[model samples]
Target chain A: MTVLATPQPTISASETGTETVPLLEVENLSTEFATHAGTLRAVDGVSMSMTAGEVLGIVGESGSGKSVTALSILGLIRAPGRVSGGSIRFQNHGELLTKSASEMRKIRGDMISMIFQEPMTSLNPVFRVGWQIAEALRLHRNMSKAEATERAAELLERVGIASPRKRVSEFPHQLSGGMRQRVMIAMAMACAPKLLLADEPTTALDVTVQAQILDLMVQLKEEDGAAVMLITHDLGVIAEMAQKVAVMYAGVVMEEADVGELFDEPLHPYTQGLLNSIPRGHSRGSALKAIPGIVPNLLHLPTGCRFRDRCPAAHAPCGKAEPPLQRMPDSARKVRCWLHHPEPPK
Target chain B: MRNYLLKRLAQTIPVLFGISVLVFSMLHLAPGDPADLLLGPDATPEAVAELRSDMGLDRPLVVQYGAWAGRILQGDFGRSVVLNRAVLPEILKRFKNTAILTAGALVFAVIFGIGIGILAAVFHQTAFDSTAMLVALAGLSMPTFFTGIAGILIFAMGMQVLPSSGMYPARGGDFFDLLRHLVMPAITLGAVSAAILARMTRSAMLEVIQQDFIRTARAKGVSERGVVWVHALRNAAITIVTVLGMQIGYLLGGSVITEAVFSWPGLGQMMVRAIQARDYPTVQGGVLLIAMSFVFINLAVDLIYAWIDPRIRYS
Candidate 1:
């Protein structure tokens, strides 16, 4: 557990006045994917925001729609999928982002960057890694081929790869998995985008490499002054890097708060279940505390709280209607469980 | 990859030899000897015997096969007993016609198939996509001869847009005229090829559009077209190429009924005439060319794999 004991001194709140608005503001975002069976609401009414240079972690089990939420913010959901309702307000140097696909394309890699989960498949095999990175710069900026190539080498070096010049000429298949991911990061950082979307950036790597990559991202994010939306299933990574934590379960946000607050007092039963599910060293020999049931099917979600079926703290009222994500009176935390309060107001 | 290619090339020799052997034996074993067929049923025994000896059909089976095989090795596919000339040259003339038709049809198939496939996959279940897929399904169900007839009826007889049949003008003026004559048959052939290829492309594109990289591309803010063309299409390319390669083979195999109906003098029509006349040399020459062309196309596809995907290497 590499959770920080004290908040980093660099981003002290007093230094930058609260007047500085958040770089990205996602509000009541819901996305559904069409299937033969029926429409599946993969991301249901999720909301979050990130200030410049801030790191936000979205943690959940598989199928919790954490990834979908991140993708929805970027308008990346494809056919059979559509963003039913929501607004993703991105303020990059105060320029708004409501535009057509072509207009959005101009801003995508230029002003905002994204790193995918699997580096092996993300990078196109037919092209050189340098070409991919150079393409981002060339498409967004009006740089000549020669200049983009030179800048690509510099980027590879910035990402800490050795022999950037030689490596630039090689295809993606010639590189190792970690190196490919580094190349992806380098590409994302090429234009110095203000917001970086890292969707499970390190989940595919080995444990040690995962830490190294996360550290590299943090270091780069500090230098670039870019906000990051870190989507992952690993709570350890979230504990280590995220300033804010968002917990999701079965296509809805279960709990969200400051990292320290969420860890110290996990209000939602699903969040508590997820934290308890992590295997401790001493508890290895014994049966770990597992969540009793699997996530309910998103297409046929339960009527009330989606997690009520698996939640140990469910009451009779939970079966009647879905719970709303409401704030706790004493704290800044927002939770979506009825157990935290006596009952839902009529 | 280079080593792998060299190995495949080395293996193709045995494959070609085996195909030739099987084709020659089958043609020879079929009823009616070439010499007898040429002399006809009303011919005297002396004339028939003279024809058999002249045609080298009087020799032992092993000796005849050896001489014919030796000539083939020397790039001489033996003489057509009826035509009184080398079978290779005669076959080559018709082979050129088939080759042109195949080339035309292939270009049409690839362009239309890839275009429609990408559009349908991108639009998915929209009316446009449904209509495109529906057209593809109709194309799939219609046989080649039916397509040719429909093409002739609409374009030639009804619309008066193009000529109905034949590969070239009887006088054989310019090469362009020959191409102009081939358009209808080529489109008829291409329609069938396009049907299967379009479905394959749509399915392949569907599978690829779901990959994380395509999502990453979209997340990076690449436009819908860019996400599809640059990311999804490129990833789906290997599968598309595989289908395209197979379709090319089908096209190159030539449409027999289409060729016959249109009076297009391709290898297929030539082979039909040779078979009906029991011209062993001509039939062997036609079958051998078709097999060889198919092998060459497959080899070309193998070479293309390395270009399309850097993961594949000849060494």
Candidate 2:
């Protein structure tokens, strides 16, 4: 690992006014799904920016829309889902999303690639491992069959698969979960995409395998200079891999800061609840710290702030209107909570 | 896989035996006299009695069953009293017609059923999906006879497009002519299977698409087509094949109304004619063939189960 002056670069040198042009700028993205009860706001007003070479971790619980955010970026959200309001702008890359099906198809595996949570089910069992890896290469790169096959084998080896030449001929069911995940990684890396979105890539693996996969991703990110959007509930993985962190609750971002600063000091009550809920080594004898109450349903989220119902610090004003991301006085860290910053005197 | 095949084959014996016994007994008890029908209404009593004795229909039921069983064991399905020759040869000749019809129907059904299934599933809940499913529902509700008549009227009567029915031309032996003759009957037989399969495919695809891996495929930036075809469709294979296999058995066993309406020379038509003439031997032979085909089709399905799903391995 190469160490720079500061692990979290406020803004990289040789780039004047670069902050004005985020590599990816998602502004007030709200995705809704029509349901029996009401419209569910799966990704509500989630806005975040990522610079090139930045690994941004969006951490949240199961229903917190972290995965949905990653999926929205790829334009993979299916019907019954509407991207109601928002603009996702990419600076050098054409546009964040194309409503045109054919254009979306082109960018999917070529420009922006993703790895899913489960390696076992993600792969087509009937297909050979090498063929699946070659598919993306053949589709996106216009590579010949022979060239794609050869490169697929090489990719398997690059992702640390042993005897890739022989293993490539085997079907997915023949490989173990960890090996399958490695194959997933190989497939994602086939086109050398600029942004690699990994949504719980290591969640289905054992602890040891998870560490290995995480390390491999970090190594690949550094080597390829690919920005990674890591979505997971594991703060440890976030701490290890992410340069920046965004804590989400009920489809809204609760806080955004440099990973170091966020880990050192989490401002929003929801963020603090999540950090406290982690099973620490010192809390072995005692009960694990779990945040009281469940995540509110997106169909009927509280009017003001989504987390207010579960937040211990919620006040009467919290029920009136939602809080927007406001910078802290001492640092560049942004928190979206009324407790941290009161509304201007009316 | 070899072991699975051997196991399946071994398991078919009891099934075939049971089917033979049931068919033989039912044919024996059927309310008709072959001798009376063969000799005609004007024949004298002694002459009819002599014909019955000659055909061994005068023997006790058990003895007649025993004789039939013994002959079947020696690969003899006995003589068709009406044809006055070996039952096997007559049935086999008729069977060729049925086989052609079944094969054509199967080809038509599998292609159209699976095609519509994939289309409906991929376009789930859309206008196309809804329209396809609605057509399937209509197909299921309309009886085979109605569909057969509708097909003949539309294609044969109104359009003046092609030959309406029958197995071959009057001149005979031309493959293209036989295929052309087969189209209407095959369509009539295949329609219901296609409808059933479309519904099955829709439900199966719906279930498979909900699986976690489908989401994984979509997130991997796989195209919508790839997600539905390569991932969801393959995952739904076992169920789809199961419905198709059952349809295959149904086609082979009978296409009665379709055969009658189209005048296709299938076993179903032969069975009806045999029953009307009280040709006991021919009826028994037809029933036995259908039973055996049903058993074999079921066995084929069980054997293919392992091939389609790698999770099932014969111990």
**Candidate 2 CAPRI category:** acceptable
Q: Give every collision pair in model 2.
A: none
User: For residues B204-256, could you state the per-residue lDDT of candidate 2 as single tens digits?
Assistant: 98898887767656655577788888777777988988998899988887587
Best by DockQ: 1
RMSD of 2: 4.4
Clashing pairs in 1: B1-B313, B1-B314, B1-B315, B2-B314, B2-B315
Residue B102, candidate 2: Cα error in Å is 2.2
Q: What DockQ do the predictions score, one after another?
A: 0.48, 0.42
- TM-score between model 1 and native: 0.88
